[model samples]
Target: MAKVAVLGAGSWGTALSIVLADNQHEVRLWTHRTEQAKKINQTRRNDQYLDAVIPEAITAYSDLKQAIAGVTAVVFVVPTKAIREVARQVDPLISPETTIIHASKGIEPVTLKRVSQMIGEELTAFKEEEIVVLSGPSHAEEVALRQPTTVTVSSVDPDRARLTQDLFINESFRVYTSPDVLGIELGGALKNIIALGAGISDGLGYGDNAKAALMTRGLAEIARLGTSLGANPLSFLGLPGVGDLIVTCTSVHSRNWRAGNLLGKGNKLEDVLEQMGMVVEGVRTVKAAYQFAKEQQVEMPITEGIYQVLFEGKQPKDVVGQLMSRNKRQEMDDLAQLLMERYSQ
Candidate 1:
């Protein structure tokens, strides 16, 4: 078993640490809050983040250097906005041989950078090849209880990608590997926008037909942007893409969809955010994605409509009407065009 360092004491981080510990791997779980670290280390519980008993094999620490001093891999489970700061703190403690698997999803608001790019900016020692992204439909709440969940581990390097798959796969949890790091990362980040749209539809009392269309067309937009930036088109249909989108959009566990539901119910954005008490990634991601699409000249009507409703105060009903009235074209025209262009290169 490998000695793994799980940075961040959030629910996802705590959940992943438990999984590694249950797999007989030594885990050094680090948290920014000393109280959280002390609580986990002493009581074997993280009451604030996860409502479950922590594993005995998992050791918790507040210090960055000591937590990562001699570990085989470092798993980043921090919030998307805090990724760069957390990576900066852990950079000095890492070695070239150590594998870094980042699990945070969502793009940075200011830089509009993917989490992997943020990590790249923070860590100067390794290239993008050294990084791996762990993402899929698995939620922290269910995973903490060891419920059956499947996820994907994506990297530019084939060996590193497969190694991550082997590290996390088990009977209750399955792992798949992919070389489309960009597609995996992009899909994981972008799907939250569609989930927000899905939630809005739910809030509006729209039926499954509307939600299904939003997801299908929403995925096409994501594929368009991803392919423009060197991602595999097929990856959008896989775990980190469609799989992640389905769960996030439909599950009541999704904070993004829930927030959008409230917005559709006519609650102000600030009020909804204050009530949740947790970060809702889709709200932030919509702004970044909308801007990215414009800058890249990629057509993303669904994302554009969602952005207007969230930030520009467009009525949810009006946005829906606009989407339904748009010009229709062949379902696979854009995808086919992008794929053929990619293949010719």
Candidate 2:
């Protein structure tokens, strides 16, 4: 069995460690906090993040070098903001043969880089194609419970993607592979923006019709931008795209959706964040995507509306009104444009 280091102690990281341990791999679950490491080792549980017990094959470590030493792969499950800092710390410690896999989903606010891109920028020891991304509709809470779930692994290198898929696949957890790294990352990141909008819609007491429309149009916006950035439009139809959108936008387990729900219920962003006590990735992704959309000249009214509500202090109901009252257009226009752009290249 391969030795794997999961560089984060959050729910997702812990859940993935459990999966690795179940698969008979040696797992090192690294947390920056020494107290957390001690607690996990003593209690065999990560009470703060996960409800399930950690497996015996999984060990917790506070030392970054020790956790990664001689490991075959390192999985990054940290927040988007922490990716670069962690990468920098791990760069000098990891061997060149170590496979890097990141499951964090969000774009860098200023650079608009995906998590893989951000990691690549910080870790010069590894090539860009060696970094694989693991993402889909699976939630940490459910995965921790050993619930049936499916996810996709994507990389520019086909062999690397397949290797990652093999590392994570099991009867309970199915893993698919894709070569459209750009599309996979974009789909995973951009869906959070729409999930926030969906939450806001629900909080405003809107019915299913409103959410349905938001999800559909939100996907269009995602494809528009993803295709513009050299991604395959068809990838947006896959697990990381539409599948992820449905789960994040509809589930109460979604931090982004919960944050937006609080905003729609008339709570301020600061208060919402304080209550949640976790990073709401959608808030940051909305800012990054809104700016990126403008730079790319892509139309993303829903994202723009969410940005206004979150940043410009626009009322959620008023934003919904603005969206519905916009000038009418053919429903298939976006798909047609996406098709033309994708095939023309």
Find the candidate with the highest lDDT and give its number.
2
lDDT of 1: 0.89
Q: Which ten-residue region of model 1 has the weakest summed lDDT?
A: 332-341
Q: Over all chains combined, what TM-score does candidate 2 have?
A: 0.98
Error at 46, model 1, angstroms: 2.2
Instruction: For each of the candidates, give the backbone clash count.
Output: 0, 0
Query: Which portions of model 2 miss their true places by more than 4 Å?
Result: 340-345
lDDT, residue 140, model 1: 86
Cα shift from native, residue 293, model 2 (Å) = 0.8
* Candidate 2 Cα deviation (angstroms), residue 138: 0.5
| Candidate 1 runs further than 4 Å off | 336-345
Error of 1 at 242 (Å): 0.9
CA lDDT of every candidate: 0.89, 0.92
Error of 2 at 85 (Å): 0.5
